[model samples]
Target: MDWKTITQIDRRYLYIILFIFVSIPLLSPLNLPILVGEHAQAMYDTTETLSAGDIVVCSFDFGPATIPENRPQAKGFLFQARELGLRVVATAFWASGGPLGEDILRDVYGSDFPAIPEYGTDVVYLGYIPGNEVGMQTFGDDTWTAKGTDHYGTPMADIPLMQDTRAAEDLSLWCEITSGTPGEQQVIQFVQGRHGGPAALPLVVGSTAVSVPGMMPFYAAGQIVGILNGLSGAGEYESLLAGAYGYPTELLAPLDAQSVAHVIVILFIIAGNISYVLTRSSGGKEK
Candidate 1:
């Protein structure tokens, strides 16, 4: 086929072809070695250091669009957190984050654990509060004021776990998974700095790839205790979760699929570059 004709195919069609080609590797098995990175190691180390009965705040600030990237991190974190017997205090910084947080709990702890830790006892969810940074600041100062109730509309004071809880300092660490504004900033300025000097409370964050640049400053300055970025981060966290609980290998097939797809995309990019160079050298347009 002529170069012009070949290129005439809609770009979306190429994407579809790539999608299906990638799916094949996913459906089949490709055992890629899992490389542990410094970031994931930091996250693991932070969580592992938790003392028994220490409380953890899992703050999900992500929306539905980013669920693919952040949800897995939550799953990995929650699975490991439960194994460690740490009490969890979950919250959603955005209205959209509420449902996603519940889904994460249901997907990970619902069926597998089945016991679904009683709300406000083993875990508690403070649903959406709309003031953005202001809300976080208020919650950091007083959770009950900012969010008067739990996800189920029960009063915060009535929840067993929150009976003694008032602010971020009460928790051992706050693990934030978000994909938008007012996430890292809110936690850092409010919870991490509630007492005016870095809050002494440890902080962990999970963010989309696009947020890495903005978040690096916090990580570098020690404002954030740890970070989990993108799917690679999820895979690393998953690896840790898998090891700790001896979770079935079958459940991790999606991570394998994702890793394989990334490698294939890289190869495709290299091949495409090479083809363009050769065609230009031969005085022809790229096909």
Candidate 2:
């Protein structure tokens, strides 16, 4: 057939329409039913186990690239800590994480939830510490000495929250939300390994989906307590946070839109397959 005839036969417009159809729903979320994953449930359960007056170290080990997946996990953990009246001490290894960490704390305690935990008393930001494994080692050794000042250059000793925090052992629990290389290994080698059995403190993790497979080894070894991986995991956490702490309905719209977009994508895949088979069986005829 001529190029003109081929152009007439081709249904490229269908593909274009499907793309827009999928994109629109994503841009405008639907707030569909959320099914919790086993990993997320474990993280949630572990977080709930914490009691009032406990201390949790939130180590933001990932950069801005992972904010979408890692941010919600941080939110869930922070609120859980605050709800139980637990003291939170947040720090980061990645420089980019500084802003991301602040944004998360502000988002949860600032507006959507709108119940700011007592800043100096309830939760405090230790900011970004430069050294990777060495930093983790030092932190496990002495919290204040390792990080002398908070993110804003305020002395840790002056911060009421940092008063009792000396080492990983002093904290009730520790969570490392990591994406790339250093933090997870650092936690395993320095914090989890350096400290004895119960003194080691429970370690929870939030990582990208691609990193989850590699992270399982640590989980199986009983090094890490819990894990939340990728966007799906984040979505479940968002639902959980919204349920326990109540999110603005507007904030959840994107999650619903994602659900609809996923269905639309699946439908397009099945339809494409069926069309391919029918076209092949009809001796390459265009109908």
Candidate 3:
């Protein structure tokens, strides 16, 4: 093999190699070493501190396109909340987020949840609230006014979980599993701290990796108490929770695919750079 060719490998070959590397990990998880970050730890701590009977509101600001990145986060939070005996209120800003939130909860709770609901009393899903920021603000002020009924078409007053839990003031924490606009930013703007501004209602975020840089400012300023970033962050969080709860971590194994893809890209970059330097030293001739 010509060493200089490393810098000039066919793009198709690169694509094929990358496909195999990514697919292999998916088919057979490598279970790569995942170092839990401070943000994911903070997220865990936020949920850990909440007392039983305290209500935790989760805003699903994501959609089907972002399932892989956001679903694990929902699992971690919902499972912890269930074990802690805490109540949860699920709502969504994006149009598609409502059903996804319900599905995520059902996966954690039981297939019977919200549908045949053996676990229905403690959890209420408000479903898709319209008008994005306006809807979030209204719900924060008075939960029933924003949407009289839930995703299942049950009136808010009829749902056991919603009977007394109106407004953010009654809740203990705000957690958002978010993707793009009208997400955490909108919550920060309209819905945060409706309980009382003495201290802004505590916020925890679970966001796509691409959204991490944007969320850092709020996290730094303490507007967000914790964050779960992208798929890797989800896996890290699963590991932490598994340590505490002894539950199986489904994400960490599958996460090897994403991790392998990243590592493969980095390796290619390094190899190409080395080849470029060698080519220059050899007067631009292939060896």
Candidates in order, TM-scores: namely 0.86, 0.80, 0.91
- Per-residue CA lDDT of model 3 for 1-287, tens digit only, reads 66677877788999999999999978888777889999999999988988988888888899899999998988888888888889888889899897898888888878887665534477888889998888889988888899999788888777888886788788888889999978888877777745564154788898999999998988888888889999988888899989999867888556888888899999888888789888988889644
Q: What is the model-wide C-alpha lDDT for candidate 3?
A: 0.84
Q: Local distance difference test, per candidate?
A: 0.77, 0.75, 0.84
lDDT of 1 at 189: 81
Candidate 2, which segments miss by more than 4 Å at Cα?
Answer: 1-22, 111-117, 197-199, 247-253, 256-287
**Model 2 score (lDDT):** 0.75
**Per-residue lDDT of model 1, residues 239-285, tens digit only:** 76678777544324566777667777787676566666666777887
Using lDDT, give the best candidate's number. 3
TM-score of candidate 1 to 2 decimals: 0.86
Best TM-score goes to which candidate? Answer: 3
Candidate with better lDDT, 2 vs 3? 3
lDDT per residue for candidate 2 within 48-75, as digits (tens), equals 8888888989988888777767887787
Lowest lDDT 10-residue stretch of candidate 2: 1-10
Return the clash pairs for model 3, or none: none
